[model samples]
Target: MRYGLTFLALSAALAALAVLAGGAALVLLWPAMSFGLVGAAYLARRPALLGKRPDGTQAAWALVLLGPYFLLTWATWRAERALGRADCANEVVPGLWVGRRPLGDELPAGVRLVVDMTAEFPAAAAVRRHPGYLCVPTLDGTGPEVERLRELIERLRGVDGVYLHCASGRGRSATLAIALLLERGLAADVDEVEAQLRQRRPGIQLNAAQRELLRRARARPGA
Candidate 1:
């Protein structure tokens, strides 16, 4: 009877964690992963739910279930660290005026082309007027907009370098750089990318229009 009750409690806890994790994904990413872990812990605790194990078999089953979680977490942490390190390296470029680490900066001279992410401001206007292309808002890591960005990058004619600028250079701006280099397999140094932004423009301050654009951009999944 005691064992049966423990199983029931574990089941309830797992259900609660699922709901909580789903809710958290709306606001943050990492916390949702934590909630996912509760379900795994429940499984590790209740081996019989899957199949009856012989005595002393629980240890093997526990390892099987928990091993993936540890590996995934380790891999994710390593990736984040690598990205952070890349941003740090970019910070040393003297001419680029960074609003924050790995974000917003001045356009370098040979960067005759610009790809502008849609957001309010003089910066957006500057990029639009500059001699390149315009790629509008896309959600985090998915959808038709992402495809459009790919097309734009591919279609670009001769240009020394492309400078992508957005207001405040946070979500959509930084996300685009990450996707191009990391997800889409484009090769561009982050520091060199920062140099292409126009330092003379009034800092990385975003007006009301840019803020609204970002809110909409973030509303997309996985952002």
Candidate 2:
């Protein structure tokens, strides 16, 4: 019994370690590493679970632990699958999407939308006249445009998608858009989204930091 308990404890410890490592990796990779730690845990415990018939108490204990585990793992997978092609960081709020250039027509209903207005292709500036839309200064991830993005999100009802110019599709605007979506509720799969954007918009460009930020933003619950 003591040995069994020790083994269980060890598994839990290893799971914790995996979570840290996987979570760190996923912050920059998005869905790439979301389930890595959880998968590791299940693999670690599989041998023990198969070794004997779990009795009532042990079964109950297993239920307590595995129930939440399964739920989180399943949810993570669902999020990853659903958000595979979604652009933006991890913390984007509840709702948002990425649409084609000249975005207004393709936006989803009840979703707040924005687009780039700068001259730079693939990475540009926010439209100065547009009050509630998200835009950026350059593909390099600099400028004051980022500060006002939160205000824009706060003023909006629901975010559908942020549109981008075909040339400047993957710059600071994309990162900011992803951040706002995460602030609203989108998954941080910026990498996948960016990849798709590049394919769709051949000349689109994005710098490393903006790309990194897109994968790391965590969603703000109830925001």
Candidate 3:
């Protein structure tokens, strides 16, 4: 599931279990596996799968996740909308969009680029087919890497449409979208743009780290 505090807490507790059990962590393997699969869905990697496919970890792991993991994502997104949280996706600007991860191949009509911020999922088949995909593998509840984001922003300088996505479209995706706006000089004030974004998509939110990164983008250009 979501990383930040939850991932860290669970990991800490699991470490305690191992220590008290004299390293018999396997005693908790079943529950550990469950938690790990959920974490993978949110932030882990099958990097080779993103390769043209390092992530060649041979096991039923990929099978389980790509199959059931996706179903779980579907249910989660549905529930997110039902609870007045984040929806599947939203177009914030005419040519720029932000939202949760796309579970399928076909993107919104003209979205030629898929900027996946999470670590695990591969670009959809269609995205790979057309070679219009980029994965910048950031963990949930964190900010993305700096240099890659700059390069991608430059690449998107005049593109007709782009879709920026993270796990829930709430934090990471919105943060990046705000940076893009600031970089392109479309919006000068961070708070104002964020307000506009929230109006368009009520569930849009940026975590503290995400907001700090955005602030850095303004305080230091091309950073």
Candidate 4:
């Protein structure tokens, strides 16, 4: 939050500079300021970040920067998609998979559940027909909401297919896949599972906080 706000203020200052200096300054700093706003929107995503507001009223506050935020994220998503070889989910376990936000009809045939772990953007069209769509709006680098971690771990089970995703299918979605593995006893060792995930999805990774989530999740009954 601190860094995001700093960038927001910095971007505003840069915009002011661009307007005042004009010409060369305007040309270079305008694009720089635009990028900074996008960074600000991504970093300070919490609903309460503004005046410690209520948990669910971020829309009105976020309207100001939605333009740049969507443009940058969508562009990044497209760049990643364009460079990738496949658009569909990559199965880690038989019933579980990880991938970027599904577009159009990219969800696998048996995917009965779609768990989205990103707060950046919405991509529900791919999962529109699936009834068990879950939105665990999470910050980019953070783990799932700890208060609901247990519930999320449970929800990942008993389904024929659970399709999990984030911005790049590398972190958040991969972390959920790790939770499913441990929660369901499909895998016990986090190291081994991570290694396996990397083999299937070469870019998959989990952060410190997300690794902590997997640690706590493994302490479940009979787990």
Q: Pick by lDDT: which candidate is best?
A: 4
- TM-score for model 4? 0.75
Per-residue C-alpha lDDT of model 2 across residues 66-161, encoded as one tens digit per residue: 444435434654475466564332212235333322323433444444544232222212222334454432212331233344554455435344
Model 3 TM-score, 2 decimals? 0.69
Off by over 4 Å in 4: 1-16, 19-64, 217-223
Relative to the true structure, candidate 3 has a C-alpha RMSD (angstroms) of 5.6
Query: Local distance difference test, per candidate?
Result: 0.37, 0.39, 0.64, 0.69
Q: Can you write out model 4's per-residue Cα lDDT over 133-179, one digit (the tens) per residue?
A: 77777666666655467788776667778888887888888887877
Candidate 2 segments whose C-alpha is farther than 4 A from its true place: 1-114, 117-146, 153-157, 192-205, 212-223
lDDT of 1 by residue, 75-120 (tens): 6544754664323212212322222211223455545545544211
Residue 158's C-alpha lDDT in candidate 4?
76
Per-model TM-score versus the true fold: 0.31, 0.32, 0.69, 0.75
lDDT, residue 35, candidate 2: 31
Residue 114 of model 1, lDDT score: 52
* Clash pairs detected, candidate 1: 106-197, 106-198, 106-199, 107-196, 107-197, 107-198, 108-196
Best by TM-score: 4
- In lDDT terms, how accurate is model 2? 0.39
lDDT: the better of candidates 2 and 4: 4
* Model 3 lDDT tens row, 1-223: 3562364456456656766776556455444444454554445422233221312122355545344434555576557656754556789999788987665643687888777775444555555454567767665566655655667667877887788887678787888888888887877677888998998888777777778767765665654
